[model samples]
Target: MDKPTISKNPTKKVASADHKNLSSIAQYLKDAQGSHKRSIPPLDQWQPKHCGTIDLKVLANGEWWHEGQLIKRQAMIDLFATVLWKEDDTFYLKTPVEQIEIEVEDEPLFVNQVDQIDIEGKTYLQLKSTTQDLIIVDAEHPIFMRPFKDELRPYVHVRFGINAVIQRAAFLHLVEMGELSENAQGETVLSLKSGDLDLHLGT
Candidate 1:
């Protein structure tokens, strides 16, 4: 009876285990591919921001104006970027993009004004308020106006880059539209081409 004992077969058990592992691996690969296919490009990725009528106005005047009110200052208007923040301790003469809350004579007043221009035959119907004492900021100033630090922390400089890209797109659009022409002093003059007049409004 001792000589009749037989060893148990382990081959079948090993083969079954290996088959499951291989199937699991294949499934994992399939899942990975599916995830990759469904992923979307990040917002900071290089892309063009299309220009609208407002952008055209900015390109024309180097600033965005509404109803004779300055919606955004020219220097603050980046042909290639957005303002992240205004540098502290510097005399940022340019208008701030953020909505400011001010208390005037114990009454809170928001100083946000819109700049509108009605298009009429390639020219603009301009209507704006008087800006007699407004001080314009120089574009060549040493002070840097960046976006809010907290809002763009982990991705330092990305916001600025994105803004710059958008501005460049707008400029390119203006050039393609034949709205930009070279001047005698090598400066760019943004004006409507002949026979393409439209209404314009600026701050």
Candidate 2:
């Protein structure tokens, strides 16, 4: 498949249009420093604030770019992922003091690794994201697939209202683990069950 074309100026241009919000978030991030070991911040309690958007974007392949430049620091991406928050229709990287809107080409996160574990006849799928977050496929983190022309793209809920797109490698692994089964109307389908949730891949 051809690589998706990207425009790096869009995000920064948006932020430039609204200097108030843009500067606020940028200043907060520049000054804020601490270990990101804690869980996701309590975003629901944060009152709506207008922090301008950033040039930061989460690409389709799970790459984070800033100002049209690739953010090569995995540590930086992981740190930013911890603070991802969504309010209404906007996605943000929020800290206690400020919040900055970010552009996401697809889902906010990308699942790059997957492992299957079987115990006592039950199978569990463990997914690892680009940010190194571990997510288990269960009722809480159900999988959904959307069609992209002839290809179907899969996504899974990561946390705090953020969803991670399952990349090609991990998706193929899931397909390898899929088992053929007959669904409710006796229609044969390829399905995979993790925890208590059963997902239909395809025929």
Candidate 3:
């Protein structure tokens, strides 16, 4: 199989000719964070023009790449992850002023760590992504089983309509925390509970 590659010299043009390169975009994103508190831009309100495609891509293994080069810095990855947006079925790196399309081989994120915590008297599952994005398993961020290759795999909702495929180890941990029982149809079901939210892992 041939490996995907992008030009080392990426020169994609955008509506704003002044902001022509990824470096400017990166700087803008960094500057946008005026305070220490971490938060995403109100992308819902901003109607930035669609900037042309970029060489950035998120591989199936949850690795980020730019111009065919692997992005090894976690801080850079986390910064880019914050701007990931999905429209219809395509994924893009969105900014307050512009958006650029990017390739995603599979799910854009991965949940590699999970912990069980008790809030008051209710139990909750806390999931951490590779980028350090924390998500709580509940009514909004639910887990579902999806077919991957020949086997069923677990996936959880992250944010902004994006989701993460639960890693094997974390999936095993969830199974250990779940309760197995026969459902109304007499099918074996594995379930987990968090606060008032009850979820079925699989059957």
Best by lDDT, which number? 3
lDDT of 1 by residue, 39-147 (tens): 2123233332321111111222123332234445432223111211112321111112111111111101111121223344343211111121111112211112233
Candidate with maximal TM-score: 3
How many clashes does each candidate structure show, in the order listed?
Answer: 33, 2, 0
Stretches off by above 4 angstroms in model 3 are 6-21, 181-188
Ranking by TM-score: 3, 2, 1
lDDT of each: 0.24, 0.72, 0.80
Better of 2 and 3 by lDDT: 3
lDDT, ranked from best to worst = 3, 2, 1
Worst 10 residues of 1 by lDDT: 102-111
Clash pairs (backbone) in predicted model 2: 21-52, 22-52
The regions of model 1 sitting more than 4 angstroms off are 1-166, 186-188, 192-203
lDDT of 1 at 162: 17
- Give a tens-digit lDDT track for model 3, residues 108-180: 8899998988888888999998878889888899999888777777899987888898989988888888898
Per-residue error (Å), model 2, residue 5: 11
Q: TM-score, each model? A: 0.18, 0.75, 0.85
